[model samples]
Target: MDEAESAARRLAWGVHNAVGFVFTLFWTAGWISLALLVLLATRRRDVALRMAARCWAPGLTGGAGARLVVEGADAVDWSRPYLLVSNHQSVIDICALFQAVPVPLHFLLKQEMAKVPFVGWYARACGMLFIERDNPRAGPRLRREAAALLGAGHTLCLFPEGTRSRTGVVAPFKGGGFQSAIDAGVDVLPVAIDGAGDVLPPEGFRVRAGVITVRFGAPLATGDASGAAGRQALADAAHASVLALLRRSA
Candidate 1:
């Protein structure tokens, strides 16, 4: 696809996005409610997360006609917890990751997500930490929460770019997630996602049914890295790794 959608594609996109978005909402609501109830009743967050990855996520991505291709997953040392860092491309990235990543990925979500109805409940129940990007004062608390989660052996994933790019270019990495990684002394796993933007662009959650590939890169050590400098360096290194993976996949 070019920078802009063609007239013919635009019409198809409208119908696809409208039906897809509505379907996603109702589908998600039903699944999330079931998961939430199970979690609330039995206090099993793992069950909820599993339902999401196994049932809800596939519906979101595959139901939209997005096919996934995963690479370098075997290279990952899944035995230990590492902070997952990936490029932001499209709304499908989340569902794609949920489908691609072998583990139940706890995402660093924006604080505004707390206000979102079913999603908010799901995030909290699953112990996915909220990122208060707009409030600098929330850093220490966030880092503490993040470190606790990591120390407890939960793998986390976040798009350091903060948001999806309209031009389909990878954006600069934000420092918050990296800082959390540094504080926890967790290794950073760099992931590259290609063709997701084409499958589902920024204009709307349109379905293209294209091949979306997720490439996993080697983990960067931040075990001994310290302070603000460590965070920035780790973030830069991870960003570079993601870019290289994208290039290789291209």
Candidate 2:
């Protein structure tokens, strides 16, 4: 590489890491402080959500202010529990989504993340559901857990795609989260996240602050059907919604 290009690349990396570290440090401190206060004082749902909002506010403001441009953000319902399913592009997609919908958020994460240092503990404490991808009974277990959460009237944020897109194109969903929503009789709110891949692509340490739009479409109600055919139907519809948003922006 040329000297100028190499220098620019190095500068980008340095800025990205420096900004990310500072952001994480502040967010972690704020989150732990709020959590402790909440844990000590009260367990009211609104208070808990307020505390979550505080912890999330910094990242949300910084991320959106620097990179994200949200559309259809007003469609999010703060008063009800909806099964929010989105297309995953990169890890920063989480921040974008949280910024868009700053409610009491719970993630349907992979079991692998449950082993991470502080993230796992935080996720577990916040009642995040972790699915073991390899287990034979994982699907059924997740369904049961999801149903319990649904019964309690808590919203869930899930990536039906199950993993980040290697290419920028959205991939097929695993059908587990969809089936759980169907079983629990909840509507799936389709979220389309655009430009996150360009902002922070998978397998890259550098970040390019750019406009990332998150669109919320009409929710899909639970269908009584089951098996491959039923799951595929939901997947197709969800995929179509995201594709439509992307095409519109394009």
Candidate 3:
């Protein structure tokens, strides 16, 4: 491309990012406010999840000009609860999953997130499970809490990588979430999210308009698998499934 064309494209990219950032702020503040009201009025987490699915997810994703496409959504049985595991790439991954997945999913977030200004309040109000990683007793407590939530027929979405990948590759899966699934006796649903890294790079605030694909893989049953060996097997299987989906999406 010529210099003029290249410069024009760069200018357009900057403008789009600027506008998207502003929209994201407003979207977050508005939904958080609504979430607070819902918590005060009804105090039901299901209602908050429905509101997020119908209003926040769609608006936030669409306003950022990010198109969300879900593959293998039919593989999910809405009637049954699942432990949804996915690869972590960027913050946009959360938005993409929330927009594409046709379910009221709850996240297993870090306890530190519970201290964030608006996000923490919203997460707490929605009854998301938070893990205090620094606390010595947090591991067992988290597993028990997660099991209880799953047993209560709530679907939990966890990033088995534990943190976002800076290299845009699927990292090794953690054993905690898989162990929770085993303890809860639920199906582990592997999900692969592609293209979110390009939309918003790690630790960067600028937004880029693009498409993100969320692919749900076949569920791996943790039947009678409560031991460490079983958890490792489940983790490996989930990691492989997510890697395959990422390759296919690419």
TM-score per model over all chains: 0.92, 0.86, 0.91
User: Mind giving the per-residue lDDT tens digits that candidate 1 earns over 1-250?
Assistant: 7745687778777887888889989998999999999998999777788888899988877887878889999888888888999998887788888878787679889898888999998998899889887788998898888888887888899898989888878888876678767777778999999998998887755577888899999999987667777778888899999999999955
Relative to the true structure, how large is the alpha-carbon lDDT of every model? 0.85, 0.74, 0.85
Q: What's each prediction's clash count?
A: 0, 0, 0
After superposition, candidate 2 runs with Cα above 4 Å error: 1-12, 15-19, 60-65, 76-78
Q: In model 3, where do residues sit more than 4 Å from their true spots?
A: 1-15
Please, what are the lDDT tens digits per residue for candidate 3 over residues 11-127?
Answer: 988888787888887888898888789878997778777777888878877776678888999867878999999999898787777766676789999888899888898887777
Clashing pairs in 2: none
Model 3: lDDT of residue 116: 88
Best-performing candidate as measured by lDDT:
1
List the lowest-lDDT window of 10 residues for candidate 3.
Answer: 199-208
Q: What is the lDDT of residue 124 in candidate 2?
A: 75
Per-residue C-alpha lDDT of model 2 across residues 174-229, encoded as one tens digit per residue: 67577767767777788898888877778754566677888888877766557868
Off by over 4 Å in 1: 1-13
